[model samples]
Target: MTSALPDVARHEASDIALALDWVGMRGIAIPLVLGGPEAAPAAATAELAVDLPDPHAKGIHMSRLYRLLGAFAQHGKLSPGSLQRLLREMMESHTDCGSRAARIGLEFHLLQQRPALRTPGLAGWKSYPVSVQAMHRDGITQVELAVRIQYSSTCPCSAALSRQAVRNAFAEHFGDAPGITRGDALDWISGHASLATPHSQRSEAEIRIRLSPAADTLPLLAMIDCAEMALATPVQTAVKRADEQAFAQLNGANLMYVEDAARRLRQALEQHFGACSVAVSHHESLHPHDAVASCATPGWKRMG
Candidate 1:
């Protein structure tokens, strides 16, 4: 005859009598289908945990937590309501350990197809890193969403200095010539030896916001649109000569510093989200280090 399997976690008791702030799992791989305007499948890394208030209890049921997460993969589309429900269920499942709260985090890359700047039918896929975190405690649930965006930054100081250099070159070439025609000026300016281009670098923006408790869905695509529109120089994917020229024109027109980029993003995001924080980094081409700036609305405590 066979006996029942051994149960160590439920039967044993802990020697130590201290509680942990967070306890469970991290980097749990999961397949997720995010529900929004751009609903798509994402391979996500999940972190799940519950409090262990009962010092006497040996340990929490880790398998039960993993199983609960697996259930979500089977029949859930990630959203505020579903996240809240999952956290509540986690707390209920850990009642044996006297748990009062639970938290879940997911990280993934969201893919978007971007059209060429000037080409009508050409497009390519771009990926943005995204994360969503949620917690349930004391009859309240809070959710925070975050996304990372990449753009281009042309230094205003660099542009001004480059323009000065170009003017100096133009003066030397013309040398007070009489009756210089537009064609002659155009020929000189279009040549490679005429103008010095400003320094531009790839930059990144990390935006995190606290979703209103009453929000039903995640407005990720809309938020991304607002930020890209405000900044006006998102990095391109499919590029022909004409599209590249148009992109260069856009960069020349929207020259900005790190501070300018931060302010633009803040003003635009604040119009939509009440509690939002923005951090930007410009990987300077001229310098060894990156330029960075950050800002947040009032009463905005950053979520982990």
Candidate 2:
């Protein structure tokens, strides 16, 4: 008979005797099916990992995990039902290897068709950054979904200051003529009031929410709607003069600071989703650095 192959993985001892919390793979190429069978799945990358609780076990079945993931990605639809099954299978595959936990992260872009403001035509596609993570550990199964929303943010303080400047300019222009004609005053203010405008910049809201036990599917579009509705300044698609005016009016009506943006998103998520974390960042045109704010609700469980 031929010489037996040396199974070092099962027979060899480690130089150090210690247990690791997690070990496996990250940034693996995987296609994600973010919807039901009716919707086509999208390509995505994943970080699949498991715990090494047994210090003596040479290694877990890495190939088994990969094959299982391959099957899941190929046939299974990516929703609450499919993700829970995938995580359980992963944990079961490593049961004999002394792994008590397993985790996977899928990152991908979800294309959304946005409607033009005050127009019958539809806007082009807008891709929102979306990530879903599932972890089965110590008998606790948790699933989380994260989405990034982009919009415009106008500075509340800057808006007030600009209004004050306009008032001063109007006072100076009419100081000599208290009895200035209504037409003359209206024309003067029309040209001068807009002279000092507040600075606004692009902003983003990143929200992560854990699914409730009752949830059967990931409410991706609903989550986006909640965030955009609360902020009331989502970036538009197709541009028209009327749409531009509407956008300007929105910014003016919803002047806020970075902290305000964070709280608005957090409050909306808290009221609707219940368990969530939100972070908002304003890329300031007035300053070189960006402004940021964040909050987490009580139901949120921090994941690694």
Q: Please tell me which predicted candidate would have the highest TM-score against the true structure.
A: 1
lDDT of each: 0.90, 0.85
| Tens digits of per-residue lDDT for model 1, 87-126 | 9999999888899999999999989999999989999999
Per model, state how many residue pairs clash: 0, 0
Global CA lDDT computed for model 1: 0.90
lDDT, candidate 2, 198-259, per-residue tens: 99998998999988533567789889999999999999988788888989999999999999
**TM-score of every model?**
0.95, 0.93
Best candidate according to lDDT: 1
lDDT of 2: 0.85
Give the poorly placed runs of model 1, Cα more than 4 Å off: 1-3, 192-194
